[model samples]
Target: MAITKRGLVLGAAALTVSTAAIAGTGLHFFKGQALLQSDDSKQQVADADKDTSLQPMSMLSLQSFFNQSPKELVDEVWQIIDRTYVDGTFNQVDWKKVRNEYLKRPYKSNDEAYKAIREMVKKIGDPYTRFMDPQEFRNMKIDTSGELTGVGIQLAADEKTKKLTVIAPIEDSPAFTAGILSKDIILKIDGKSTEGMDVNKAVTLIRGPVGTPVKLTILRGTNQIDYAIKRARIEIHAVKSSEVQSPQGKIGYIRLVQFSANAPTDMQKAIKKLEDQQVAGYILDLRGNPGGLLYTSVDIARMWLSKGTIVSTKSRTGEQDREQANGRSLTNKPLVVLVDGGSASASEILSGALQDNRRAALIGTKTFGKGLVQSVRQVGKDSGLAVTIAKYYTPNERDINKNGITPDVEVKLTEAQGKALVANRDKVGTLEDPQFAKAVEVLGERIQAFRNQAPRAETKR
Candidate 1:
């Protein structure tokens, strides 16, 4: 069957590598106008004139003044928080007091109101629950659409060092082509130091119109290098696959970069191709994969698991929603999953599901623990909010939020080893990848055991 390659649209409530907008919230705004009689309209105009603030002014002044009262914006944000914030008690901080505190200040401009709202949201003590201004919201939408005009690198902030670090550069992207290596510390962007810089802010600085150049000062180990890379439109490919010859036989190797919209379909094709080759088993690589859509992860998990719960989500109200897999295993062959520190969110879900169900053995280091889920709510036409709505658990009911998942076969890749593997990912196989080599060895044993246990029939002469 021919599989159609679809665009990688990020679904809502995704455990994303970066703080990209994912999933949708069912919030809608309606604008209604009331018609007034001629006399009533005239009276309203006179009443407006009586109020000096509402009186006629220059077009520019009028535009600024009537851009919806900042108080109204503040109230809108406050209401959303009051109704939908995961913690109803605002984590023991009096939410009403927070609202009153922000409202007490005079906010004549939308920028001021946004600042106030951000401050109020910050009081909740959840970094993921953030306020996205119009521009940030627009950029998030662009990210969800699975296309970006940027240098094409994912970034993360170190919890201890607080340095902006390169997570991974998109394959064939401008950043990758410019030799931007993973784990490179971003010291400066366009001459501005990245010390204490937020990942989203760094993203904003790095992204721009196509063909624009971005200068980056990177610290790789003991050497510091400066790179000038031009931005380009990046179409992210979430799934890649290959076949590697191992001591046992041909091993099917598939790498899932993220659980983007196209992931499940692309992965299905990859598995089908490998099955056609009659590979003994499969190795699913998820190292350096920042997660994407939650549903995409569930879908991918279902491809391997024929039964049992895939994942479950718990909300503040103690409501639990569980997703179960249908009995439709794509291949009954033995499988091994590879993961590392960079694997997170949806990546965790998929690996955890496979591991929990005994469908596959997880290799590599522990994963990045991010079990919380964010729901994206549209605040305005050009603005939105990503609120933490729920926490997800693996099928085994483990919540690996701060504490990550421990791989069955622990394998740690040194910095130099990782750089070498990443530098030649497409060509390098078991020879360059210790994790891959180990997985191949493990799978080879499993295949040999299966053959040894199979019942043999006597052939009639």
Candidate 2:
């Protein structure tokens, strides 16, 4: 997939400007500094073998560790592991027995120990932190986020049902070609039942090196269909937009696939074309868009928010930071936005900002409500940790974490309705799609009302 011009511009700008501003600065700097000077702390634990409830291991040992290591990067981690394992009732876990079982053969070095420890952590039944070896780090760096090699389809386990279901398939993907529609109940993969499988485990089974094939059995209605698909590297082009003329030949429709580096430029071009055609209004489709690139979202918001703060970010230091709108502003015309469950993260940011400012009317179900901001911290080569570093508050100071942004108009799409719309665009019914229908109605009203008003002097010129 080719990169959008907007994304390319944003990427270049980020590399030239933000890279210097972000690199070797902020929390990452402190974290890196701390990691370098904590050797004695490790040694103290290495030497201590007894599990005493109340034994002081010597502040001198700690100070000496600090002096010799000069960095506290891994110090806290070392201390936590030591303290937790020593007296924390580790649920009667026998470390010696585990070591004997896993490490029956002689191990080569500390790398083996790291792997063993990682496996032990997994045995505790937590999925959050998995140990990353050098090879994993390399693979992660080469692949972009969310673009895994597998049959192209989105999967999610229903929170209530806890059953694995097909979310959606990429356009022109192998899954799409195989007639795997959304919401199909996945019964098995490679003939292995999915009854007790978690989504991540299923993901692990489905994803592998490119060119490998996997078979899936899905339940559609009362019938079961099998699909054999070859895994291939999938490149997700996160943004797509065009200046499409409305059916009435009055307004222009700009359907944005996702927010990416190229979105702003693509939007600019689309708007320019619409302007040239003397379009009446705009319908911006943000449905099914999982967002990307925070700054790109900011840039798009600047086009609408003429002035004032767009969003505020509170960092770990209790300092509140705000991103102000640049001089760039839109044409001050009627705008309608569409959003739904798939619209999350940066998409929510833009939608919330526009609604807060009354710059646009939002129509759809509640957003995904991920108001937390995460920054990537490079732990090692090609391996980084993305931890929630801050929570963003909208212009109205609304927190959208668990509770997503509520659309001005609520709409739900039925499976039959969606299929009809996708199959024959002419058969699309908006009566059931209240949110989108409302947007169209609202835009029509705006067009009628704005058409009667005197054109702005800037617009007239």
Candidate 3:
């Protein structure tokens, strides 16, 4: 359908252009007479408008607006816009410009819509209000545990050089075995320079069919090194456990990467394995974990806490509420959860739940408090809005948004001090960041105290 007079008028007004009478143009617009006469067409337009309007605006009492007078709704919105966002920022935001530039054009397919939304959201310049379509949102739904095929390497963008640099290579992965080392700058991938390349693009370039070849040009120290790296299927373990018969007897250490689809199953398996080894306690490492799935966090927290609300969400409706976690728990052992500024979203949920329930002591630095829960709703074909639908409150009713969760025992990262690991030598793992040492110290002390009370063990044969 061609642009309707109304659309053109709106578009032109947004573009600040003079409008002309565009009657009988046979554009997509339904003329006033035609619109009122055709019941089916009227219903179609109404349905579309209703769909957009009926969506409960985040933290806004949208349901109440339905029964409210226009003056009331407008007043409420104005007040909300004023109170939440100062300086009339909403008025300054060109939503019509966004709609015209991004959504006005009819999409050919969902892929087109998805691409458009991504582009639009990128243009918004707010990293928080992202567009995560159904598929992408589904991926964000849980922290599953499983192995994924990709070249295994820890990458970081150099602050000064702005080049993709290898922080470390995963053991036994193609990058490690292929001689990629720390501080090796990746200049290009398959002839494309890594200069100004984002992590997503680099990841896309790095990930391909297993056994396929990817050529990389790197700067090793001052010398440039080119290597033909054959991409092999690399397995990423979300959960790894090590049993140590410490001074306090048996202690189990479980490191969790991200919350993935298989995380619960893998965590259950880890727990059973630790139980079989008769582990006395556990050290759960959540440091550097960028949260994945909400369910995964809740599931992991449920394993340790058997009690009140794990997390609660308040929707757009002041009355509408959702909560999760039943009072079923699997483990009641002495627990220490490690956290850092990198630990976000789902990680925050798990840590907060554990802390709120008194099930575990949080060690390390403060967590990355991203308490807002996003719900992806399909707004257009192949495009969805990953809108911040609600805020999650911990079991203790604390909402950790900008203010992150502080550890019970605040330990900095400088003590672990791997000199080669420090990308920024000046601020490299400063005492302000030495999280690992704190976690180890906290867990180790707890284990030692427990050991002092335990019966002396006989020498093993």
Candidate 4:
């Protein structure tokens, strides 16, 4: 019998499979089995009637055996976690015991097996690590595609209040046109109470077929407002820019909502247009920006940084991977970054790189401090797993996980001031936004200092 390299690899992987070990690794068991080829030349490896006992069979027999039970599907999830979880020892939990406990319970259906799998993953105590069902996985795909059928608003839950709050509405979206402002508390969605509702669940409820309307009960400060927003196909523009005349001269203002697939390209065009207009300085606003793709963040960082480590990742075996800038500096203009509590993940990566390299001055409140990296892999044809594979650090080797990155100039926003800023965000040259106003002031001083320090040329005879 001729054994192929792929067959050998599959056989080795199957040999390592044990009932006691399984859970946090990124493994696609269904897909792996589908890749293996059956040897038609061989006869029946095992007869069901003759052997009723459990025994190791040929590669082809193993595939057939694995498909008969949903328990094997659960075991695949467990084994992946056992081998590839961020913590090698399952965070000191009795992983084998946990596995046995789940196995002991009879799973009558595939749903029960999925529930068991979720319960096993929750034991790891990492919120970022999660098992996504088919619907949840589909929603994730819709979010990343930059176009979705929904009201079109970014949302975040308050840590203290646990209330679902609107981060920002996409420009020209139904939510924005319906007057959904940042910091607005959503009491209910489509008459469904939002109390204690997970953000993802709420999103699922809010999104529906285009042309349908979703009713939202919003709490703005002490007053409550109701709006019926019709769902539409929203195309999110991750980057928005404009040139504003400031106290010094024309300053480039760019607001980065999220580091989506189109962020780098959109930002590149924004920067090029601003530079062409002869802007003296730039302010990159990341306030209320819930972060997105990691590679997009790194690509954006490379545009500003001439040379330095952008970000670093540390894995379970103390393996460290560093992403450094590619020595590409697009503009020498004085740069200032604006961040707040809403900024997270890839936002932190970009801010940390610029601040550590002394390329930009960070101004505003602290960041959201989500420093873990999640690798999403398909479990079966429908489901998937988003596992936290590593913890990331800034260029200065600072791990800002629970503790966020503090700004050089700390400016707190009062409740009333926050409401006013959201209302006037579209008004250009409006100094009512104190944080942005302060950024413009700081950049003005830096630009003036640069001009004064420049060596003047001598007048020719």
Candidate 5:
């Protein structure tokens, strides 16, 4: 939808404003980024006049603007996607017509607006680009912190089956305590069927204030189970570290669950502490890590790599932005990364960077293979839109969207063993976990080879 108020620039639409002209035009956006207009909304002003329902008056002065309407929300979502979707082609659909068609429709309620937003997003055929209601948006913000009030679990929609699937449950949270395994299909929430529910809607139904109760109906293989879990302030320690003695020497064991804003700082502390203990090498566990912030992943990648390209993002216009290490690595010791099918997004970024640069050996199954980058923007007064703004690639220029990164040594787990680890997360980094054991073995070889090259290493040298 072409919304022009004296040719006022909205998101980065292809109007006519230079980068300097958009210096101070914004409507109090998130983290202070001025979302601009893009070519998706580059329709002529005459198209806006054809709506008939909307007068020739500027969009800022519309009666609907003073009193919020569902139509207003619909146009806001339309504008954000038009400006930011990675594919300027809008997946080959006429972006301007889609916007014009949606803005022309009448929406009576917020639900109607949300429904229209979902329908409009479906045209792109990218599942990562979706809309979130007000409550769902707030919950997403809470997840950035290391704590939240909910039965901690990450959910996603299975692409092929379209089922509401569990990516992974946060360790020791209410959901994990109730034995929620990864890949379990959530059939219902509090007796409400989730046949066609989106992840945001399910998250809104599942999250509540601390000490509240919620029921979840899950489908695991051939059995349907019900779990009544109480909501609480689930503390998510993104980085968990300890020193484990191996034949190679003391090893730093660090498990990163989510790449939140605090991940870099926490990881630095772990690495520094392990270095003080003179650990020979490291084991970074990214198992069941549904990734968080994109920039956070880059920062962590730099901590392990003294010099290498971390990751790169290519926009619709073929402009690629690369993040590289600036020689500030925390340690230069050999490293082994643990990954599985749950390792996705930012997780893949860090692991892929390390693998591509030969900085670390990966031991586990293939990664989850989600390389798309989404930008979240505030829509209307309460809702938010997560639009896929770009697609990322590994340092080797490999696009791992559906095809995951193969581990240097694949340590596949049996269904029973996988379920057992899900049942008891405390046993994750121990020898009982087969992947960790393999990582230690592989790391021992690296360390031994590393020692052989030293001047007798002068012992600890």
Candidate 6:
């Protein structure tokens, strides 16, 4: 719809002219109606005064405003946040004042508008809420779909040292093939140092067109090694399943790398195949999973949970959404979940839900606490914003945000042991893996206890 005179003149949205508009139009007003410097603006204003339709260039179409003034882009993002932002205080930044301040700036280019948006997002004091440029937006969508064109290494900054660290390499991707183990501290991408670099910036630096080589300077322990790894199109099979023979019985082992859209389907197939085989127990390994779609996690949660709340999202505005299982679980086999520092977001949600509901025994170290929910919204023709919309809680109403869910049985791996296991990925779910070994032990104990109680309960009844 075309922006009418009232919409532009009455400050429905305060928009300013970009440098491109100033270069084209001789005289143009930015704050109010975009009046031309010539007598045409006067005539148009006079026409409005005479009670006729005020037809200025801005009244042509809103698209024209979008093309000429990047300030509209600013307002476009501003309006979305202003309307739907869960945080009433906008993370304690005066959101109203921020809009006016940014709108007042003469945006020289779309980049300038994007910069303003970035700074504005930063003022919200949320690291998760960020502006994604066109390329980043595209990559983010691809990432959630279990595909991406990059080195295929998930990265995060150390909470204490704040150094850019590798979470884990995507299985069979370029980084994984290059032997880039988990917990490898990235010193630099190409030649630039990663000091004070966030994950977003590091990602921008590391990723490029497929087949292109991106050199990474990695600090593993005290040794500094340079890896010239070529980027590739990574298609991640997030769920992998196998049957392991153990003392307890045949174990259905499933490793979930990330909660991509296909996770639920894949998980169902895996569980069904294992159930048909009559596996005594199941082991869900969510180690090094960076997480994906929130709904995908909920869907997977339903695959295991027969009933009870799986997760709940509560916005700052008190808008709450709760998900519950509907008795569609594939099997009721004794279950154990494996987690570590890399298990984050959806991983935490799934693990926390299972742990809280007593559906599974968690056997691993603490999880990587990232509980904020983000909504990916398009800003304009291109570019997007990932704004934090809510914080999720487990079935027990535990907010596992920064403080991750502690496992029922802590099987912590030391730095060396963790590095070795990551180096030899084949042993990840086997008895050789200390964490997996502990999971087997815990599952055996639980299975024995259940067996011990079965006869006594039956006789009493």
TM-score winner:
5
lDDT of candidate 3? 0.53
How well does each candidate superpose onto the true structure, as a TM-score? 0.80, 0.63, 0.57, 0.77, 0.83, 0.80
**For model 3, where is the 10-residue window of minimal lDDT?**
15-24
Query: Positional deviation of 418 in candidate 1, in angstroms?
Result: 1.9
Per-residue lDDT of 1-461 in model 1, one digit per residue for the tens?
A: 11112111111122222323211111111011111112112211111001111112234322433355777667666766676566778789998988888888998787888778777877877766777777666555432325556787767555447677775666667887778765689999999999866555677788777888989999999899999999887766778888888888888989887666567788899999999999988899998776766667777887899898888877687644687888877987888989887787778888999999988899888987777776554453335566666778898899987677999999888877866766776544565689888888888887787678778998999
lDDT of 5 by residue, 227-279 (tens): 99998876778899999999988999999987755677888899999999999
Pairs in clash, predicted candidate 6 = none
Ten-residue stretch with the least lDDT total in model 2: 15-24
TM-score of model 4 relative to the true fold?
0.77
Per-model CA lDDT versus the true structure: 0.68, 0.53, 0.53, 0.67, 0.72, 0.68
Q: Which digits, one per residue and each the tens of the lDDT, describe model 2 over residues 256-299?
A: 65454556776677777777877777777777555555656777
Q: In model 4, what are the clashing residue pairs, if there are any?
A: 22-78, 22-79, 23-78, 23-81, 24-81, 25-80, 25-81
lDDT string, candidate 6, 357-414, tens digits = 9999998889877777655444565565655566788988898877889999888788
lDDT of 2 at 39: 11
Error of 4 at 138 (Å): 1.1
- The better candidate by lDDT, 1 or 4, is 1
Comparing 3 and 6 on lDDT, the stronger one: 6
By lDDT, is 2 or 6 better? 6
Best candidate (score: lDDT): 5
| Model 2 local distance difference test score | 0.53
Q: Candidate 2 at 186: error in angstroms?
A: 6.8
Model 5: worst 10 consecutive residues (lDDT sum): 16-25
TM-score of 3: 0.57
**In model 1, which runs have C-alpha deviations exceeding 4 angstroms?**
1-68, 143-146, 156-165, 177-187, 194-198, 217-227, 452-461
